[model samples]
Target: MSYPICHEEIIEDRDVTAQLDPRGDVAVLVPAAGAGVRLGPGRPKALRLLGGEPLLVHAVRRLAAAASVHTVVVAAPAADLVAVRELLAPVAPVTVVAGGVQRQASVAAALAAVPAGPEIVLVHDAARALTPPGLVESVAAAVRSGHDAVIPVLPVVDTIKEIGVGERVLGTVDRSALRAVQTPQGFRRGVLTTAHAAATDPLTDDAGLVEKLGVPVVCVPGSEHALKITRPFDLALAEHLLAMGR
Candidate 1:
């Protein structure tokens, strides 16, 4: 039998909490440098407002609520590190570093800032600002339980298609084996560092790089609340979700 994640699970921080592995001292790295063109430009993606506050503020606050999360390192837009730092200070104690043009580069920058003691590191997305602290701890716990890499995922619900060209669908794809992967992807610090070191191509997500290293990646259940805020519609929906205290 499993219990639902509720407000009572929240710790000393504002609105969230998590169950943690005693051995997993965790550091979270957020790559927030992306210019979300799909979000219609104006502000950097992570700096974009949700529920009247920057996404970074919400994300950091939720992350710090986890008992085992010892540090948060955010790779912010190189030009706005000071402002980003200022905005998030009231939310959580974070180390802000200058981010890079590409997502992978920003992750590398944040990884460098992670302190020495944490045995596990999680690479999270700032766009997934509403991720539950339970999911965060679940990934960390998996890493501590001897998994080299861990990711939270939801089963793919929509029918899939394989398109060739010119908007043509070549064949129907299988959804049963597919998953919509979410972030705060956890990794052993050594494995993550090695994966980054060997990375040659730039993939959007960190798990792909780990897969390239022949490291096995494990999956855990994710939350519906952990939606990635991308478009204008997503932002509006997220506001509603937050307002209702979902």
Candidate 2:
């Protein structure tokens, strides 16, 4: 079973100085430079307010709490590189670099900044700001356990349907074999590097690139707290969840 950290725990964790081992086995890359058009006009998605703090701050606090994570590399908007560094300095030790126009580019940039230590690398979304430390450790543990690639997933709870050209439903699809994928996707450093280098078309997630190489991606149970904040409703929902102290 997966245990998720509450909002209170996250706030407390941020106050303590992170003592992550420099030689730890995992490096986390957060691609946080997206414009978040779906979320309406405001600061970049990662920099948006979450409980009075930027979403990036909340996300990094959780990442720092994970024992297996040694290094954190964030790809921030090019114009906000310095600002992002300053914002995160008080929260945790992080390397901030200028992000590219696209999410894949941001991940590639952050991945390039990773040092030589960690053999396992995780690509996480800054939008999934409330992801727990345990979930981060779990993904890293799965990668450490000999999996070439690993992703956290939740069983799909909504009914599915196949739609036709005119928005007509073709048939109801099976839900039992489907899952909703979550971030903190883990991969062997070399495997991720190679996949990024060979990438041609832009894919939604890094695992897709690995899948093209015929690599098997393993899945572990995911946390509900790891929801991505895209639209205004999502932000509101996150606020409610935090208020409830869940």
Candidate 3:
């Protein structure tokens, strides 16, 4: 497949949710191995408390509920592998394994554990604790519909600026051309494996690795509830969002 390197045109999403039935065909990988230095230093980001429970607990629980998803694999910190397994046992049946130091390595570890049956694989950040099952299904649906790769995105509302040294504003960035990418990023299982095999330099997201191979990635609508829990304020906001039944 020839991937377009150009920006993808936005396709508005409908209100109706997909009735995804990817049973035994979709595998989800959650890379929960980050130190999360921004969320205030007590525990690994995924293990940190959110609404009186670990963030990983909320993330895995949601993915497991999706009808399309059959397997959920977690990559935990080397020290917390056993603890993470115990924490998630009651919420959902997940496979917990020791994770590598970097995010990409952790993803590769979880990817290797995914069974042979699933043709589609999704890489979701455990930090997106409140991601709705509908959004998960949407990405998976796109892949099942023959897209090689897909990701969820929200339009950027705030004005963006480019800064230079000495704190001087260099130029204003066009926000209209930009969309904030979110996860549960979906891919063909073979494409994901190939991307990992070819990766050399470090990257923040798996889609970028696929992009390096010149594959075009499509974008789907994302929910505000899928906000990543990064800073102290973000955690507090997530707590508030959860309280509102979001």
Candidate 4:
């Protein structure tokens, strides 16, 4: 089955307590419909099992745990909307929507479902399942502190190389100036909506869309625990990390 870019299905847990907290002024959008080709998938990346739970479950659980986050909207696979909603109902009060073909479209769909109360919106990846609540709070705090855009990043540590067409190394590229970026990338509600409205090309991260609008994106320290699970090796590593209580 196919769904429109803005198709949405809201699922709420009445038993769950009010989502608002002392600093609850943030909403998180999760685009989770990507097929995990790299992981040699049996299921969609977000639905893949991790530590006995779906990656989406782990991700949303953490996001819901954050004091600043008042809402979470997930863009799930069109066919799996019911399943995804059922999966998340016990975990948190979330609104599930049919995701679009591309990640950008899914984000846009999820963004549309965000209610008005939250002024700070965050775009997070479901593949980063182990991202901690602290990181969520940090990103929201940065946005709340008056920054229009905020993202988590870590310094690149590996030796860099510039490659040619035939897989030849042209030269050693500078790594000092490069940083590895991560999410839940935060933005003021107006800033994010405006960026999306003005977006032409689909970029890998929301910050890239904002960059095109001449907005300065601030970066905070990212945690190793936020490593994205993309491959089988990454899954194993995540399992190990989980066992180690990371």
- Which candidate's TM-score is highest? 3
Give the backbone clash total of model 4. Answer: 0
User: Model 1 segments beyond 4 Å from truth?
Assistant: 1-24
Worst 10 residues of 1 by lDDT: 2-11
- Show model 3 residue runs off by greater than 4 Å: 1-18
How many residue pairs clash in model 1? 0
Candidate number achieving the greatest lDDT relative to the actual structure: 3
Pairwise lDDT winner, candidates 1 and 4: 4
RMSD values, in order shown: 5.7, 5.9, 2.7, 8.7
Residue-pair clashes per candidate, as listed? 0, 0, 0, 0
Which TM-score value belongs to model 3? 0.93
Enumerate residue pairs that collide in model 2.
none
Candidate 4, clashing residue pairs?
Answer: none
lDDT-wise, the better of 1 and 2 is 2
Q: Is candidate 2 or candidate 3 better by TM-score?
A: 3
How far does residue 130 in candidate 4 sit from its true spot (Å)?
0.4
For candidate 4, the lDDT comes to: 0.86
lDDT of 1 by residue, 40-111 (tens): 969899988887888888889888878878999999998998999889888888999999999999999999
